[model samples]
Target: MKLTVKEERCSGCNVCRVVCALHNAGAVQPSQALLKIKGEFPDPGTYKIAYCNQCGICADSCPEDAILERDGEYNIDYELCTQCLICIDSCPFDVMVVTESEYPAKCTGCGKCVELCPRQAVLADQG
Candidate 1:
């Protein structure tokens, strides 16, 4: 399965970010989110949700073995992560954003972000 986000409908409200944090980390902050929202307002307002494609960049880049693969997906072990930002830099899509604590967070593929998205920008497909 893969996810596709609609950039046009995104209002950059950061709701997906918020929801991701809440669901994954049990927080309400966007910085804790795995997905990122980038774009400015009053100028075509193109907001894109930058997140993981289930790619293993972070997992392979991790030097401390903080990242791992499971069930055909990549996941971060928060306890093992040293916040090195290596995975963040390695990501081609720039989906992994740096958190306040310095660790990089990527989409967990929990589909929680999709459920909270008001615009239904995030899509899950099985093919």
Candidate 2:
């Protein structure tokens, strides 16, 4: 499944990011969330949503074989990850992120981001 965005429906409330971080990382930090909201203020239409589409590019690029696919969902195995940053470099959408602690972050298709979006801007589907 892929995470699709409807820019027009986004209200810049950041509820989706907040809930995503809380659900996946057990914190309220949006930066740790798998999906990110990017744009400039004073222009709501300019907002752009960036997220993983489960295309497997990150997994394929992992030199350490840390990234894997299961049931069409891609996930990073932290225990095997070598902090190579190969996945980050291969991500076409630039959605893969590596934190200061050296943890690679990407979407696991958990659907938390879709559930908490107030405007239903983010969707998880086969498309």
Candidate 3:
């Protein structure tokens, strides 16, 4: 499953962030969102959507074997996670973010954020 985020249509209203936080952490705050939006102020702002690309870098970089590549995707075993921040630092996309939950949160390809996005910015495509 590949998640695609189209930035051209994003309004930066933060609907996707709210949805992500709600789905992953059962909260309404955008700061808790796994996905992040970075942009500057003013008209014609260039938005950057950050989310896990489902890449296996974190799993491969883990020395503790806490991260695993399962069914072609990476998943972290919370019980085994020592909060080392290795995976968070290893993410090239800067998608893996340290949330209020302590451990980093990676996109689960759940499509909840995609569905809740008002701008239709995020999408889950399985090939």
Candidate 4:
């Protein structure tokens, strides 16, 4: 399953990011979120959302096989991770989070963002 966003419906309020950050990192910091929001200056009312599609590119890029998928979410195995940071370079959506934990942040597939989005713009494509 991968999260999808309806860009037209998003208001850039960042409720999704706040929720993701809180759920994943225990903080309200948007930068810790597994998803991203980019402003569209030309159209002030709309924003673009970037979230991990679970494509497995980061997992494949890991020389140590640290990244793995479980319950449709990709996460780093800290015990196996080598701090190579190659996964960060391979992310197409640029959502890989580098923190002091020495592993990249990933979506927990907890569905909190989908349930809490005020605009109903976030969705799960559970293929």
Index of the highest-lDDT prediction: 4
Worst 10 residues of 3 by lDDT: 37-46
Q: Is candidate 1 or candidate 3 better by lDDT?
A: 3
**lDDT accuracy of residue 66 in candidate 3:** 87
Write out the backbone clash pairs for model 1: none
**Which pairs of residues collide in model 4?**
none
In the range 60-108, model 1's lDDT, one tens digit per residue, is 8899988888876887898999887888888887777776566677777
* lDDT for predicted candidate 4 compared with the true structure: 0.84
The true-versus-predicted C-alpha distance at residue 65 of model 3, in Å, is: 1.6
lDDT per residue as tens, model 3, 1-127: 5578888877777887787788887888777777788886675578888887787898877778888787777778898988888888888887776878688778777777788788888887654
Model 2 clash tally, residue pairs: 0
lDDT-based ranking, best first?
4, 2, 3, 1
Which regions of candidate 1 deviate over 4 angstroms?
Answer: 78-85, 97-104
Off by over 4 Å in 2: 40-44
- Weakest ten-residue segment in model 2 by summed lDDT: 38-47
lDDT of each: 0.77, 0.81, 0.79, 0.84
Which residue ranges in model 3 land beyond 4 Å of their true spot? 41-44
Candidate whose TM-score is highest: 4
Q: For candidate 1, what is the TM-score?
A: 0.75
